[model samples]
Target chain A: MSLPGCYPLHDAIIAEKLTKYYGDFLAVDHISFQVRKSEIYGFLGPNGAGKTTTVRMLCGLTRISEGKAYIYGYDINRELVAIKKLIGVVQDISNLYMELSCYDNLMFCAEMYGVPRHQRKERVMDLLRFFGLEDKKHVKFKELSKGLKRRLAIAAALVHKPKLLFLDEPTIGLDVKSKRQIWNLICKLNEKGITIFLTTHNIYEAFRLCDRIAIINRGKIIAEGTPTELRKKVSGNKIIELQVSPPIKKSTILDNVDGIIDVNIGRDNTIYITINDAIAALEGILEIVKKLSLEIVMLNLRGADAEDVFIRLIDGTEKNIGSSTRR
Target chain B: MIDMLRLEDIIKAFYIAKKDIKEYYLKPPTISWGIVFPVAFTLAFILKGGHHAQEIIPGLIALALFFGTTSMAAASIVFERKIGSFERLLLFPVSYIGIALGKTLSSFMFGMVSLFATLVVVLPFILNIPTYSLFLVAVLILSALMFSAFGVFISFLIKDPTNTMMIFNSIRLPMIFLCGIFIPISSLPLPLRLIAFLLPLTYSVEATRFAINGNYDVVPPIESILLMLIITILLILLTSIKIRRTIP
Candidate 1:
């Protein structure tokens, strides 16, 4: 059966120019975005980049200073009750009651969300097993390792099966294996059509999990798009680094190198060339070295990634909002 | 509204409170406050005044109730803040009323346990009077709730646990001494009497004194109960408002 449009306007989440000020400082400047149904929208930024502040605004934990945020067609400030009912948040910290057992913690959350008495036990057990925490059901939260604690936090947050899940730096302090597992779980949840709003400084996690990403800096959103789109919009395909035995001296040799857009000289005598094609640029640089009788020590090539776009957006000289903004 | 507080939430609160109370007792200094100080003060004041042991017994009980309840409430806040449980609760569908009720009830329950244990130790030696017993009991429970709410309010206002204790001491110590918990409020000067009235325990201790000594002239039992009820309501209202705004 097709759902009716009259069934209330549900877009999962819409944050319109949401701004938050703490004293005189703007923690979240005028920023706006929307997460459609079943999309894992990644909020990408550096440490003090206001991503957490934006998440806090959407969850209604912090009041918005200027604009409005809505969840499931309900304005956060005006309809907080309805918004809170449909949303689940996994904050950076593990806020589970350390003294309570994992089963008890899940049950506590289920009960608070008003799951029926008979259904609570089944729901609690399902969530525990889903997170691979069934065996540690009776262990106190404090005794659990950091990764286990994060998993338990996720389990407790999902006990009510909310529609829009907000995960703020969910895998920040976890081990590599645990982080990969969490990434898989997040993807699984997204595949089940649960809209995920994630905020993190880990570019690789965002690349792996997010369907689309917004890069925030200082307090404003600088750029936003899918991972593939972001890589395409930012110039350059590969980064070529050349460490020479006797550092080649010349501003003109690099300036004349074709396909190399930017050259960065480091204090350690390593030359970093941002290029359109690594294969073409590497051949050209080698030809110049052969002609000049220059000695080559080490060469490294890496593909452009979100971290590249992020750095260019924040620290780069030129600023270009992606094509999506104009359209 | 009561349904808003889930059985699981209460259970969680209880578990946390139990662990907190254990940690509290395990600390070397808290043992002195829990066992040594109350007993020492009870004996020191009771013996110093000879037949005045009866006069000081009710006050000592009220003092114990205050110390036990407020300490638990403060510890609850410190632990919750440290664990970021307060932020977790704010993210949930639960209302501020639910959080406040859970916290208040948990601290009050733990406090009563401490008070009961202290009473058991002190009861066999006291005068064992039954004057205005219901009124005294009512005041004890009411003052405990009010002070616990106050502790929670103060907890949200400060960032550090040590700071919470410092602030609690600045506010609670004066109330203990001047609120007729250790002496008669009537004997206090006019300025101090106003300060005593600001404390919920003053009316509590006054009623307890009346219950124990049959001295119900200056303040009636009904008047004391009314005062406590009004103060308790206002404190809860103010605390709820404060806690709601302090969520961030």
Candidate 2:
């Protein structure tokens, strides 16, 4: 299916059938996506879904097994040095200098990027303040808490003010406060006109932070859209949950209901029904309950969100929704 | 622009050297290996007797320099790699050669400092020995450079720091025995002498002996210097290749 505006709008990154293989195992299958300039694009996937591998391939940290990708129109394989200068990568692991103090780590990164010496000190200090790590400047990286270490890693990556930032699971294994802080930092960075390509397994983070997201599963792009768009794709059906007083055994009675699409009965005697129209299917559901003489204690209707869309898509139950997926 | 790129690499190398020295140079393990071990080893030789000490003084100094530099260099690289900073270094725009040179230079400096300390401790014992100060300093610097390159090369080959030390001990202990450090190369049997010829430390020992005693074995002092220079270059080249491949 064609992606909306997939024609490359001064694209910061573009991948066409990008693939990777480790020995005989295919780690990443043919996957294609584009990230536009100043866009906050999220790569959402589960563990070992090839999200990290794809990010590495884009940043020139790992060799691509097949297909092509470009950063600012430069071929990823041939123009890596040029690409390296334009992008900053924060890997899944906090790969910073543990022996060096926070200040030294930022300074060293600045020097490596050829930041002018006159501006180096100022820039490092500014980053320390920006990340709220100014007081921890003298502390060795190993001595800091895990959240501070991650903040320092991100600070070091931005030492050169890269045009595009690739953050791989930036909020993984962090406290809620730290996660929220990092989320604000990400938004601030994007506001300064830097393109962000974030890979995350946290469904809420993707929904809250990303302007557009692509769901990947088993090394392929399963769905792609804004959170609202994705939620809408699963909106044709509504979910109704019922708590019954007397536990009903058989759900086959609702199979003949005209508008009921699917029925699931929980061990707690709660029946969940999915239908194209909740109002149209409610009478039929109530009729079955009446026949069984089971009292309906409570009824609730839940709206679809990104999480629901993601679960339905990954579970392979919403096959019709993904066939024409677009972002 | 080309000049700027070259200048940036030089600056980066210096930065790495400075960072390494600050982080690992004066740490307890470095001090123990660089200062304490050499002094203890030298004192052991001196306690054996005056005559034996006189004969082995130069060898002891060479041993000190070799072990001190190699250990510091290998340990630093392995530790950085273990802590995941080495992979971060690879993400920067610096050349592989710059990184190798930065590490080599720091290791070489550590070796030089250790050698000087060894000399200070050995000074009072000797009464009359021929002195060629300039040649001696030159030989010592070249030897340190060669060994530092060797250390970096070995660090790249071995991933784990503990395993690297194990392999380092196995390799360096044999080199000390086979090199002309304790015994002159000519005194060894044919096969053993052949092994001595192949070791870089052999050239360092022979050249140092010639400078101090006005006598040489195997190759002349000038040839030994040339061989050390060649080995240093070859090792540095090999280290650059290794860094590029391993990091990429």
**Which prediction has the highest TM-score against the true structure?**
2
lDDT by residue for model 1 (B1-248), tens: 12244565455445444545543444443444444565566666666756766767777777777767666667667767776786776766655655665566656775676678667766665776567677667767886777666666666677776676677778777877788866667888889887877777777777767776667425677788788777766665566677677755
Q: B1-248 in candidate 2: lDDT tens per residue?
A: 11122666777888888888878887777788767888788777876857767667777777888888887887679888887777777778777777887888889988888887888888777656646768888888999998898888888888666687688878888887788777777889999999888888888887787777667778899999999999988877788788767733
Model 2 DockQ vs. reference = 0.55
Candidate 2: docking tier: medium
> Where does candidate 1 clash, by residue pair?
B131-B211
DockQ in order? 0.45, 0.55
lDDT of 1 by residue, A43-112 (tens): 9999998998898888888889999777877778777766777888999988888777899888777867
lDDT of 2 by residue, A1-327 (tens): 122354555888889999999888887899998898998999998899899999989987788889988888778877776777888999989978767899998998898888898999999999999999999989998899888888998999899999999999999999999999999999999999999999999999999999999999999999999989888878997777778877766667688887777777766667667778877688888887788887889988776656668877777685322221222
- Candidate 1 TM-score, true structure as reference: 0.88
**Native interface contact recovery, all models:** 0.57, 0.53
